[model samples]
Target: MPDVKFKHVVSCSSEDPKNPAANLVAQEAFRKWKGVAGQPSVSVILQLEKSTKVRALDIGNEFSAFIEVLVGKSTDTEDAYH
Candidate 1:
């Protein structure tokens, strides 16, 4: 049997620059991803970026905060989708 595994990493950062709600939104977005997969072996990394003038956060600064969701699937799953 093929040991199929799926993983996804998601990151969120606010575009408002000063809006604290962006951090909250990122957290909620990460939490929401928990339901994306029902398999026990599936793994995910949720990252948040809160930038300050003194200490810059890795999260990017652009117009309209965005949540990036990347989905990874194992080759073993190729048969399942078909």
Candidate 2:
């Protein structure tokens, strides 16, 4: 959402140089985040600036077959995504 602000990218598997992961949060529709070829799968972890409850998500990915959203706290373990 426009209210949410991302601090930085914690980690990312792949991303296009022209269209980086930061485009995902950008308001411009022309700019988009695209992964490189030859990869089995891709993943990106975007860290938020603050702890805020997300009631909903707006996913608009037509290129990928599927996408999974994982939410976790700074103190929670990897398995805590549920």
Q: Please report the candidate that would top lDDT against the real structure.
A: 2
The TM-score that candidate 1 achieves is 0.19
lDDT of each: 0.31, 0.77
lDDT of 1 by residue, 1-82 (tens): 3212212234322223344332333523432222222332322343223321223223442332344434332433432322
Candidate 2: give the clashing pairs.
none
Ten contiguous residues minimizing lDDT sum, candidate 1 = 31-40
- Distance from true position, residue 44, model 2, in Å? 0.5
Residue 74 in candidate 2 has what lDDT?
72
Tell me the tens digit of each residue's lDDT in model 2 across 1-82.
Answer: 5567777777788997887888765756654677886676988888888999888877777567779998898789775776
Model 1, residue 54: distance off in Å is: 19
